[model samples]
Target: MKDASRRVRTEGITGAAVSAVMRDAGLTHGGFYKHFGSKEELLMESLSEAFQEIADRLAQVGEQSKPETAWKAIVKTYLSLEYCDHVEYGCPLPALAPEMARVDKAMKPRIFEELKKYRSRMLPFMPGRRTADKERAFFSIFSTMVGAIEIARMLPEPVMREKVLASARELLLRSF
Candidate 1:
């Protein structure tokens, strides 16, 4: 059950492929139902795990001497080839945000909580004169980071991928 949870958390639980992967790992399809009360249950747990993984990783970017320096570290990390290549092991914002809109209604609140946690994690490093300014920084940083990664992953050419990511990083770092 722990292995299944770990695998589903890293990957996703929306499709047959996910179940198939579990089957390949020696778990029967019916075994999933015995362990999880419902698909939503599995999804919620997986999302939680993914959210924690990101929170832990981002937390490592500890206090920067300056806001811009911190933002640079963040932007570079989010847009790097390392992050893009390791989708399953890294941030789910880029991988799971699109699916969030289409997830089960019962699971929406859990997903929202994960997003709130993510935004809050970023708030301390942003330079804000007011709450609204801080809010803008939150959205700007998240959008840019996720957008850059998603765009980079879509390009067929490796050079274009690097270019797109680098450009997004530059724009985001300068936005504040």
Candidate 2:
């Protein structure tokens, strides 16, 4: 599942071929059936795993930092070049959301559930007092972070990408 999650994050759900996923997992293409019934099933499970990976990461950042600084820390981490360059290990939204938006009806509910779970995990570290305020902050912060990473990933030069990430990081930190 790790390989599948990573593959889908680096290559969109549509682009990550089953044979490549199988090969990366050290299994033959035929072996894929022993796991998932279909590619959509594979994507469903992998996307869940991907959300878990990022949720745990964000939770860890919140746990390890001072409460007042947790929001800033998360923004910084999410907007870092490391996160930008390491798409497979970073948040799933930037890479997956576009394709996810056009996923089949069967997959939409599953994806939405995973997103809600991910949001629940993220809300605690958001920079706001009221529950409503925190909820708003969560959406605003993450949407910007995801957009920043996507744009950074699209740039050709490392310097240009870093500039994008750094600018977003600075602007986001100031919001809190």
Candidate 3:
């Protein structure tokens, strides 16, 4: 499952070759079904694990620091070039969004549930007095973070990539 998570994040879920996935896992191609019932099932499980891992990391950051400091750390880490360069081991959202959009319809709700939990976990870190205001801020910060990383990763020039990350990080922090 961990191998699949890495593969699907670095390679798209449907784009990754099953044979390569098996090879990475040190198993024969035919051995796949011995573990998962189907490819979709494997993808779902992999995504779930990836999301849970990121959530745990964010939760740990929140627990270890003051809310404002934790929020800054999470944002800085999320927007860092190191995280952008290591999609296979980093957060799955930006890496998988395009592919996840086209995945089996049944898979989406499960992914959405995880996303909801993630946002709820992030809510306390955002600054807003009202629930609705905080919810809006959460979406804005979260979406900007994900979109900035995605756009930064797509840039061919290193300078342009850093500029995007720096700009988005500045804007997000200022908004809060």
Highest-TM-score candidate: 2
Residue 110 lDDT, candidate 3, scale 0-100: 82
lDDT of 2 at 15: 93
Clashes of each: 0, 0, 0
Write the residue-wise lDDT of candidate 3 on 58-104 in tens digits: 77776787865777777887888877778898788899888888878
Any runs in candidate 1 off by more than 4 Å, and if so which? 1-12, 16-35, 64-68
Q: For each candidate in the order shown, give its overall lDDT on alpha carbons.
A: 0.71, 0.88, 0.81
Q: Which candidate is the best by lDDT?
A: 2
Please write out the lDDT profile of model 2 over residues 113-144, one tens digit for every residue: 99999989988898889889989999999999
Q: Per-residue alpha-carbon lDDT of model 1 for 46-103, expressed as tens digits?
A: 6676777776676666354365476567667778887887677667777777777887
Residue 34 error, candidate 1, Å: 6.3
**Candidate 3 — worst ten consecutive residues by lDDT sum?**
21-30
Clashing pairs in 3: none
Q: What is the model-wide C-alpha lDDT for candidate 2?
A: 0.88
